[model samples]
Target: MVDKFPAEQQRIVKGLQDAVDRLNTIARGVAPIKVNKASEYFDLPEASPAAPGSGVRLYSGGGKFTVKTSANKTVTIPMADVANPANFTSPSTQTGDFASASAYTQLRADCARLHDTVRDLQNAMRAAGLMG
Candidate 1:
């Protein structure tokens, strides 16, 4: 085939064959380019606030993932806290003896316990960066 073509045409054919061979090699994963580093991954830009009834938009910025809903509500999740679950501590249990008191006293104690539980939950959420 080389002998059938002129010198210039033969060079062009060789170049084309070389290009095809390189593509085939890549397709077969013989010389694949690996993306092992975080920097090599594609980064998604922060999205604008979603329009009403348009659904939600999610993106990452300032070390947090922001999800903007069509209702104009934004929920920001800190990536650092999510990536490290071991850093989150369970809220301490609040104990009270509701059965040991009179009916009215017990009711008050129960309400106080419920309030304490709610406060503990809120504190836990704040500490875990789940709330402001």
Candidate 2:
């Protein structure tokens, strides 16, 4: 009782809707990634005058690279500057922690759904001879 072309068109529309839904679901599941700053170098309390060596000690803290000199002088080099001083130790590139397992699971599920939608979309396009 319905036109064959309209029926087929409806099927294609439904497939596209499904694909969009999957994409939306995947987007919701995605997580943002953050990178951590490199550890900094600190100067331990000046050893007694007669004490052993004292120069600079490496210390990790908020993402910043800093160094302390023997005279209790401290200097911090912005990450951007690390590269300016060619031949200098490159700043650390360690990244921050990751999302929770549950979040990851949800993301994975969404990705799977998106994958399925892509497949369906491809099939619809093929049936329409939109592809060679």
Candidate 3:
């Protein structure tokens, strides 16, 4: 039998999505993106204008927080995260022509792979006899 850990986990997730499919449109997210997770704040590369702990979640590239298992979630950022300074530029964390081009590409590819893996996992889990 194929591995049940990851597969079953994904099936459960897919089942959740399938169930949500019957919900009203209003319960869904906007057209572009539909998510209610707190970590969604980092969806953008931009920094938040609001001060720290403003009782709001933002896309600022600072601070570290736990996510899921917190495996690759232990993150640390420099103060240069958001520079409202007159001379604002993509910080070192940014992967532009200035930064390591190859590293940027590799990271991009890795993210894509991870997304697909999780997606497949979720799909597999929903396939009867895989998880449930």
Per-model RMSD to reference = 10.9, 35.7, 25.1
Give the Cα error of residue 92 in candidate 3, in Å: 14
lDDT digits (tens) for residues 1-132 of candidate 2: 967787589889999999999999999999864435436744434332222257764343344454555666544443331112122232233235456565566557666666766676666555544444
Whose lDDT is higher: candidate 1's or candidate 2's?
1
Residue by residue across 1-132, what tens digits does model 1's lDDT show? 456666689789889999999998888986656667565557668656554577877776555677777877776764332222122132233247434445556456666666766776676668655787
Question: Can you give the TM-score per candidate against the true fold?
Answer: 0.29, 0.26, 0.23
Best by TM-score: 1
Candidate order by lDDT, decreasing, is 1, 2, 3
- Candidate 3 deviant stretches above 4 angstroms: 1-98, 129-132
Q: After superposition, which runs of candidate 1 have C-alpha atoms over 4 Å from their true positions? A: 1-42, 80-132
Residue 40, candidate 2: how far off, in angstroms? Answer: 68
- What digit string (tens of lDDT, one per residue) describes model 3 on residues 1-132? 876687689889888888778564546655655565565344444443433332434343544321221232222222222222232232436534645766666666666666766666655545522344
Candidate with better TM-score, 1 vs 3: 1
Q: What shift in Å separates residue 39 of candidate 2 from its native position after superposition?
A: 66
Tell me the spans in candidate 2 whose CA falls farther than 4 Å from its real position.
Answer: 1-97
Residue range with the least summed lDDT across 10 consecutive positions in model 2 = 81-90
Local distance difference test, candidate 3:
0.48
